[model samples]
Target chain A: MKEHVHHLKDEEVNILLNDLLEQYGYDFTDYSFASVKRRLQRVYINDRFPSFAEFRYRVIRDSTYLTYLMEQITVNVTEMFRDPAFFQALRKQVLPVLATYPFIRIWHAGCSTGEEVYSMAILLQEMNLLHKSVIYATDINESVLEKARKGIFPLAYMQQYSQNYLQSGGQHDFSRYYAANYEYAKFSESLSEKIIFAAHNLVTDRSFNEFQLIICRNVLIYFNKDLQDKVLHLFSESLEQLGFLALGAKETLRFTTVAPLFKPLAQKEKIWRKIAT
Target chain B: MTVSLPRTLVIGGSAGSLDVLLQLLPSLDPACRLAIIIVLHRKSDNETLLSDLLATRSVLPVKEAEEKDLLRPGMVYVAPADYHLLIEPDGTLTLDYSEKVHYSRPSIDVTFSAAAEVFKERLACLLLSGANTDGADGLQMVQAMGGVTAVQDPGEAEVAFMPRHAMTVMQVDRVLKQKEMAEWVMSL
Candidate 1:
């Protein structure tokens, strides 16, 4: 049997969750606890904290550390045209409907680092609806939102993202969208022109506007059933009548309160249509 | 029937392993008081029928792992495709869509390390037939945490690199034959 370094107890994780909610008013209480605990554990262990008590103290005392901790806990892994079929569905099925509207408002709830938001922008630009579309790319983390606003990503990722774009029904040379300088690819200002990056915590923030389509993919999986339902309800209220909603491939509206209001627009693609009330 | 509760038997494999599972699952003790976890490197798209296929073979309830699912004894939880399956200190399973570790999303390393940290001595990890080296360091972590670690005998494995890799990293508790794999898990 080998010696164990400091391992976080189940109760200690609960204490940290409580501390987060009380000290900062960031309500991660309703996130899927298992995943949350695992992610928190990673931060705690990665930083080589000798004891749980000291780690808790650092989080409670240092505001900067708290923000860092918050970022670590949030599942920020996102990619351009992730699950490309979903994007294809957006291009082929949903966008045409949103194109009918004089002005298009697309809310990217929990749009971490804006990869999908940028993906959306590219789609809109291709459809010639970029002139009318305003993409609200909101994330809980201001830092990721900042990155999103810059519209620069690692040049290495461009190849795969380009592949995803082609799979998602992209026609033109994907390189036409961005300029690569050294190791970074800076997207054209034309695509970023219509996007508004803002800090919005799903747990605490209220819907600021209604939209023709709401894309909150892979975001709700981090949330527990109740939080998922609550956020889905928020999406439900924020969507315009006859609007479309898209979720992560694994996420569904079925068994959720919002399910009754939504009919699967592209069931395999996890797109739903909010039946006009 | 009254085996120790809350033990995690985490089995990891990639190629040439499903055949082992198809045979091993049916022989499992129906009332075995353990959370059986299967983390296979699988396809990310639809046709995720591994859990369903396993269910038909075993008497125990088998299902795809979902976000925030509490681990239960007398059941099997199969790691979903395209996501890393991680265990929490509170006995619930969580899924992540983070970047692929070792070029595999449901990387055996990711799940094994998480399960090892959470379960400690109560955890037992078994490495099986695979072509990749994903589970070696993770198996070492399980051993270092005072948990039990096992590998299918490389000689017996259809694809032996995975189990062979685990042996090179740390001293495993058991090097199981395909026939003894089920019995070994039951004994734990």
Candidate 2:
């Protein structure tokens, strides 16, 4: 048994990060150091490692241990129609523009657990565009992507999610989308079929396809400015002309250097359309 | 040049905290070099409104904390709604959308503990009037990290449960009325 250390020193954290990159080929150096360090500290304390040195030693030796650490570092907090107003704006404003295209391609970048992606699908279904749309739901973690593909969310959240759906201008009963089975509500297969779930790391992966709409909400906030700029650039290049991009309510295009490239469709919702090539 | 301040001042409150904040902001010295970070338990939509309100009252610039935003002295940063604002080791702000802790997204404890770790002895955290106990553990963290800790006197606070709860949990450095709190901030 080993005693727990309260926190890791900066150098210890750096060494562990470098070790992770060299051993696993996963680069997290560009992620926000504060968040990366905090998550690493939790991994150390929770696993009851005596010291960061030992923690790093175990992570470097066992691939399984490293995988567990990766899960901890990726923040997966999401909800169905998390901010209903954003979705309402999307339903009223963005979806209509998206309808003008014969085919719609939406990339849910970092689609943790797929709630938002499902929400998008539901909105599209209500708008009579689900059959014509293809949603690419990609996350860096396979475990979460698997969860997203299953489309099972806890029953406890259904009541709240239903409320969110109604507020977001849901055209039908939200309960119509899922079946209750004990503690989990399994969403309909028809909704899940329109989505393609894959493992893609925004940090290392390149754009796989062009999209009319790209949603990377609550994901960029975890990255440092350099990484945010890089990922935003990736999103920009991946979007076609006049494409729509939606970010988390707290996120802003105003802070980034690429601000001039996009024009706002809904400012409060962080919805923008690419105006520059 | 801004004189190097020894510590950053962090203020956290909820519910009735806004009135006290409204009073405190106007009195703060515009040239003060200590960075001020405010976290009020607020509705997610009111974040920009709060920043705008505070900016008009204070002489210093006020802005919502952005991802990886650099911290500068003589400016005020408010935690953006729906995200946990953290002080990174490199003295920048990082936002996290992780599930809310203590039933609050910008949980006072989360921000305080992170700031305590980063600034250590060069930190001062003040727990203000609020209806909940969000700031209690955070003030303890600040104190444990050899930083200064204070609470608004329960008598003067519009809603005192927050500061009163903090008073019982730890040996705080000061329990001052809102006016004295403002004076202390001015002196700092």
Candidate 3:
């Protein structure tokens, strides 16, 4: 299954990226080429394209196929409370500021399938801030956004997520947040009320609103340095003064154009606070 | 077959593998110009301080990888837990939080395959003591990419299942003795 499709040459990858941009206004040319090439090869095998030419032909000719292409080209791996320490830091360090605000606005950029959005909602509810908070969850892929809207996830994963919740200082019965429906757990509608899931492309779209807390985790590593700088600048612009920005465990704002504008709130956890002009 | 000497050495392990590394790391010659990467299955908690532990014994510097860091020679790198480490074509390191392969993030398969793709024949891989079969297919990919492959001899492995299982799926170039690993590494 690994090598059913021969390795994608550099020129072929450029061609595919160019085709996607020309036809759909989806610009992936700035994505990390090595990661993109690896994903492209996997897409070829999973979609059962007999050859690279066939894959390219279908992408150029069939708009419907582009949907699958879009979904496959981007990595969508996420989990609830993925790094508990980061969430714990949010509970201890960031939420107090949110509590001070009469109304809190949070953004989950590149929220894949909404796991972290739901996680954030749960966190706010624990702090008695859910009723006052509005969470805007956005992703580049519409399919994942659709899933995020449903508020259902695999029941088996709840155990792991529950552990994460406990580790993050959650006191309530973690099971209280969701009801198990056969193989899936459906989160309560109250949690979903605060969240608005939409498809927003970081590569192409401008900042839609100012956020007091913006969380984009493990999403920027796919991009090139230039694109990362552009997106980090966008995040800087989208933030309110002293807004909290939480990234993945290994991600950071250091060495980016926005570095001077933000200071680490929880340095080890990669949470940064926007500094004013 | 006398192929080009490999410049990158990626070692993968889980379960009882750390003991082997403690034994093997001290024996590595700093003069051997291979960029050594160690991938271990571990909890997200930093309680183990695995890199720090390895650094105490290694003749070379050992540190956890940060995103976009270049792979420099004569150094040791440990993959940060809960993320897959991928080597890009330009020899820069990148991290991915993709789905776990073999019920483990930082899966040996992810790093070995990505390094194989980039380093090709300039890569050499060693699979060590682990309870699961995570490193077998990765070893296979390394061999497929013309990289040298070695697995600890099941007899010498702390948990033989990993090496035994690896040997079943892939044709490795060497069945490494526990004490001779550093020597075998130097020979490359």
Candidate 4:
């Protein structure tokens, strides 16, 4: 006999997700619905729960499942120098503006596993500005935050990143940035010295400090318009006068509430500078 | 007489997929009864025109799967850009904005494993051309659930690591060219 498959309705899934998030205080209510629905579906199927209601009950009762759910919700798929051209643009345009400042505070928001944060630190070190720079690298995921703090990456992925680094106009041997032992590459403490990796949720958390530059690449796409606006406003408030903002190559400030507050530094690279108001 | 069971066809791929999908779509059996779900690795920000592009070539109705859309036979569903797409037990679609698996929001693993959980032995998983081995673990999970698994021949793939990795990790049911893969899906 042919067996029929049952499907959950969108309204039901939304209610379940909202309940779980609100009870858990994760604030996924503002994230893009399409994206959040898929993740929760995975959790539901993986656990062999018959329905989203069952899964939500399990989530409410089980602490470990809640942790797993949190990990599943906070996608942290970042790579070292994932987009070389963006880094190159940073070197060409933003660095010059940053050079004029006596001291700099840079924020790498949604800094999944700290790859971009380290990339920024290394760039600062080579430019002889590391001493004057303080980088706050943050993500909503604590597991990724711990990994970011450790500064270790698979040795195999380093060669590709090194290639990207060279193409982005690296001044020194990329190997100098890390020490390879066994299968892991531990980045130098000198680079780590300038960085503070922490847990922060852009959706729910408040802005920590005013920054000279905030590089939040590949993070905002997950957010819906309302949340994106709220986060952009937070960035606007957290950024000093004429401070710079860098987004993912595809992300833009054009449609958001804070759009009028920033002037494009390099439109193609998705880099913008805050306008003094 | 009992009606034939509806099958779930899961396709996972990454880099250089547009070319692969273009080639693979025309060979599919339009009359086949299975629901085809495609997981293509893509940037989260760009609008996906894949369904429109593939719809032109396929006899099956092609659309980017929306949240809560029921999975139906004779229709093709593509995962929307940047969002992981999974099937609910009742066959509706669920999108996940959760942290990326293997650095991808719409991770192949997320979808494949989710389908494997719901469909169990009725699922058919396929790995096509891609740069990373993102779908290997998911294929394994599908196989563990007694679902059928297929991999595109690395020799024929635009990027081979994805299928090649799946082949290395588990014994898949078939390694076929895109046309043969289409035929295999029809046979199931």
Candidate 1 per-residue lDDT, tens place, A159-202, comes to: 99999999989998999999999999999999999999999989
Weakest lDDT window of 10 consecutive positions for candidate 3 chain B: B1-10
- Regions of candidate 3 where Cα sits further than 4 Å from its true position: A1-5, B1-6, B46-48
Model 4 residue A50 lDDT? 73
lDDT digits (tens) for residues A1-277 of candidate 3: 4552366767888898899999889999888877787788777767777678988999999988888778888889888987788899999999988999999999999998999999999999989999999999999999889889999999999999999999988888899999999999999999999999998999999999999999999899988889999998889899999998988777888888889998888888899999963
**Model 1 residue B75 distance off true place after TM-score fit, in angstroms:** 4.3
- The interface root-mean-square deviations, each candidate in sequence, come to 2.9, 3.5, 2.5, 7.7
Instruction: Return the top candidate by TM-score.
Output: 3
TM-score of 4: 0.66
Clash totals in order: 0, 0, 0, 23
Model 3 / residue A265 / CA error / Å: 1.2
User: DockQ values for all predictions?
Assistant: 0.46, 0.55, 0.45, 0.13
Instruction: Choose 1 or 3, whichever is better by DockQ.
Output: 1
Clashing pairs in 2: none
Minimal lDDT window, size 10, model 2 chain B: B1-10
C-alpha lDDT score of every prediction, in listed order? 0.87, 0.86, 0.88, 0.80
Could you tell me the TM-score of candidate 2? 0.93
Compared to the true structure, candidate 3 yields what TM-score? 0.94
Q: Of models 1 and 2, which has the larger TM-score?
A: 2
Error of 1 at B67 (Å): 2.8
- Compute the lDDT of residue B28 as modeled in candidate 4: 77
TM-score, chain A only, candidate 2, equals 0.96
Kindly report which residue stretches of model 4 are placed more than 4 angstroms away from their true locations once superposed: A1-12, A50-54, B1-188
Report the CAPRI category for model 3: acceptable
